[model samples]
Target: MEELGISLSFSRPRVSNDNAFAESIFSSIFSVREWVDQFIAWYNTEHRHSGIKYVTPNQRHFGLADDICEIRRSTYEEAKRKHPKRWSRHIKSWQQPEIVKINHPRPIKSVEA
Candidate 1:
């Protein structure tokens, strides 16, 4: 694995988020080998991922991510302004995440003994 530039880290059982995403894709109605190409197209161009502020992967790849996120932010702001009482504090943020991690470990806190 090291020769191939792959790092192997042990993860807890059934705790991989990437595995869940892959499982969802594989468990679809279409056959895996036959429909993988089409699925990839749809996943990249059509699917809006919540992890990326609901922008499709294609948009991010083509540098349209900022424009799309700006539109979403404007829409949210307008809605919040229209119904100020409906909101408790602030409107939902439409900003794109600065970082995306898969199966990243949680920070450990040390207890002073």
Candidate 2:
């Protein structure tokens, strides 16, 4: 495998070796006509993923996310002011995350002294 340049994947202690994520990304392309054009368009333009605060990719791409978030924040503030009892805790953060990541490294456990 090493000579053939194929990377190996296997479970080790405390390390994830699951290939599901890597494998699932592959789309079957039987030719140009059968390619996933519609899905790709919708996924990028229309789909509002929860990870991105429910904003479409195009909105984030064009730097409109901040304005959108601010609008939502203001709306929430007004709602809170009118109906204080509706929120038991602080309003949700409408700010987009500073960074988005996939397969992010997990915090390492520190051994106690």
Candidate 3:
């Protein structure tokens, strides 16, 4: 790898979780809905990764990461408005249903011999 000027890093074999992010990328590559190679092609060209401000890695590679925040934030706010009521800081106790009074009288029970 060094001969080709490629730098590589390794994590401990037992600590797979340490490399989970990279492993997850590979796992998703195989598990994505579309074909792996095709998805990877599209992912590289089209999919915007959230980690790098929702710009595709290729965009970042080609120096297009600037001013993407406004676009991302605007989309985020638009999504927030569309979402259903999720929660509130102040909560009220559940109100019970209104009780209705019954006007009928109770029947007397008969004694058996």
Best by TM-score: 2
Candidate 2 to native Cα RMSD, angstroms? 15.3
Please give the clash total of every predicted structure, in order. 0, 0, 0
lDDT of 2 by residue, 51-97 (tens): 77889888888899889989999999999999999999989889898
TM per candidate comes to 0.60, 0.62, 0.30
Give candidate 3 regions above 4 Å deviation: 1-34, 70-113
- Estimate the overall C-alpha local distance difference test score of candidate 2: 0.79
**Considering TM-score, which of the candidate structures 2 and 3 is the better prediction for this target?**
2
lDDT of all the models against the reference?
0.79, 0.79, 0.59
Instruction: Write model 3 residue lDDT over 12-104, tens digit each, in one string.
Output: 533437777998998887777457778778887899765565567676666556546556556555655676364333232222212322364
Clashing pairs in 3: none
- In angstroms, give how far residue 106 of model 2 lies from its true place: 2.6
Ranking by TM-score: 2, 1, 3
Q: Which wins on TM-score, candidate 1 or candidate 3?
A: 1
Error of 3 at 95 (Å): 47
* Runs of candidate 2 exceeding 4 Å displacement: 1-35, 110-113
